[model samples]
Target: MMHDIPDSGDQPHLPTTYASVAVIGAGSWGTAVAATFALAGVDTRLWGRDKDVCDGINRDGMNARYLPDVPLPKGLRAFDDMAAALSGVDAVAIVVPSRSIRAVARQVAQHAPAGADIAVLAKGIETETGLLMTQVAEEELEGHVVGCISGPTFASETALGYPTAATVAFPFSYADRLKPEASPAARMAISLSTETFRAYVSDDVVGVEIGGAVKNVIAIACGMMTGAGFAENTRAALITRGVDEMKALAEALGGRRETVTGLSGMGDLTLTCSSTTSRNMSLGLQLGQRIPRAECFDGRPVVVEGEMNARSVTDLARRLGVAMPICEAVRAILHDEADLGQTFAALWARPIEAEPNAMDLSFAHPASDKAIQKLAERIA
Candidate 1:
């Protein structure tokens, strides 16, 4: 019969270092992230602008608008009051769209504590600015230890407590100010990990951002092809080559190629591109069927980020001369009014050059590997 999450005295001792965390945005991903944090024994506050969604979570332990069927953790509470949701939290996770990250980060700066570490859970490039979500957060929340959390997490599955993993990357080092081995990102990774949700920490912030952003674009392309009646061979090729495109853009922006092979890159890319459940992929499917863009999202409440990200990502790639034919083609279809059939034809007819890059296709780094193993040991 209780509505809001019980007081601290009614809860068990928290497992993660962070005793409290606020997740802004009541959409699927945000709700999922907040739910898992609560299940992990953290005091999780979910902030939503929509009062109805907030009331649903507070009363029913579900976001009827975003995640209707799944029951959220008892330790999770939803708040319409942003300040109240943010008050006294040890960390914050901004789960808004990349386009809104700047504004939301500013609000967080105003409300969250001075020392709370922040992580961006959204995946996309700003259409107008071409800034990664993490960059936008860093610019808006200066002096905050900002990081990124991304991988192949589906909102429903992850929220339901299925096994999920993500790469948490923060470029700044805070060991001098925090615990001996605790970087802001390392702390974030630990705070986010649960029995079913594993966290991998990394410093390749740019790489992780690129992988997260571009994969959506690639997923759109795959959806287009699939909608056009293409089969497994083509889809598989797109995924494999899509990895190259993602890797190239990341390296052009000072991200490591190896990061492209990790959870945030290959892992997320595979799931989004292959699954019709993904909004980006599904949108492309509609477009390939010659449906109008306006009609695609007519009743959909969640934003399909790839639709906008295509423009900024294409522009950024061109500015840096990164060869991203697939992403560029996607932009053309979505923005330039290019016919889907012709675009697919052009992609197929393009000059076949020798495959570039050795395509190491492996993810390894001493620090990340060691830390992951240690986490497994602790959990086991």
Candidate 2:
């Protein structure tokens, strides 16, 4: 169980931590999260679908396949059976692919303790349902308060115990939305944060989720530009314009655009777009160099979320009457098989418009004010 936090802290920091937590997924991110929690003195158990991965973790003190070099603590447990892994825990975290979130969430709903709050570490819009991972969890996870934690964290660097930061957000209405007994979002943040991994609490759940989903698509566009030998100026333009697109979509979806400028948005965008280590960026690199589509999809170590989210994001944008030209361009190239040159030309040919006005992107909401005030009081 997670202990009560002190009455005050800085960086929205938590003084206490969870006694036990279960992380779902054995991939790089999942492995790193579980190991970090264990290192922080939590009784952490990790669940992966593959028995081999579980056996390897139990025997080697590492997830040799995903995080071969990061040493896991001896106390961290790994299980192939979901129920067995989550049999006892104060909270649950889901880190599988975006596409798998629904199925995994359903499974979690079936087994997680009634008091456990759910956190979504995966980043994507459900292609089939157009629901954010948190929303999907809310839909399937009755009586559970669902929140999101995300930033520019790269798994390898994080698992090796490097300093990392992420934004953990649950709506201000988190308690009212799910159940009366739901723990506050600040507590959820506390349960996952540690000395090295500091988590900042916020009430912008929509803003956080939108940032994660959009940054991956933006990274692919940046990668394509880089692979085609574009200079820094060109890349900067793409990232800047991508932020505009992101801000536009976030506002349309009832999220605060200011949140898009924070860790989840700009921070994540900068890392993914510039790093060749990113799966989405690497895939874009191959495409830019004229690699065949069939070949680009082959042998990737992990799900290149940007490649798949391209279509879903564009589709969502259209349904909501928002303009996300860059994401749409990426969708054309990857999914519609549009000619690269024509797509680029079409993307650059759109009519120039004034940059988004500040008033258009931000609004005051009585409910949001209450949420923000609640968060402020917790960390005061």
What are the RMSDs of all candidates, in order?
11.8, 10.7
Estimate candidate 1's alpha-carbon lDDT, on a 0 to 1 scale: 0.83
Give per-residue CA lDDT, model 1, range 1-380, as digits (tens): 10222234774532236889999999999999998888878889999999988988888887888888999888899999999999999999999988789899989888988889899988888877778888888888888878899999999999888999999887754442233225666667767778999987778889999999999998998888777777788789889988999999999999999999999999999999888889999998877666777788675665788888899888999989888989988999889988676666566555545666564343334355444454333322
For each predicted model, how many residue pairs clash, with residues at least 3 apart or on different chains? 0, 0
The C-alpha stretches of model 2 lying farther than 4 A from their native spots are 1-16, 174-183, 297-302, 357-380
Candidate 1: how large is its RMSD?
A: 11.8
Q: How well is each residue in 1-380 modelled by candidate 2, as lDDT tens digits?
A: 12233445422543346578899999999999898788777899999999999999999898889888788889989999999989978889899999888889999999999978788998989888888889999988989879998998999988877888888887666343343123456666666566778777767888889999999999888888677666698689899998888888888999888989998888899889888889888888777767776677575455789987898889899999997889998998888878665566556545545555544453344355444454333322
TM agreement with the true structure for every prediction = 0.87, 0.87
Q: Tell me the TM-score of model 1.
A: 0.87
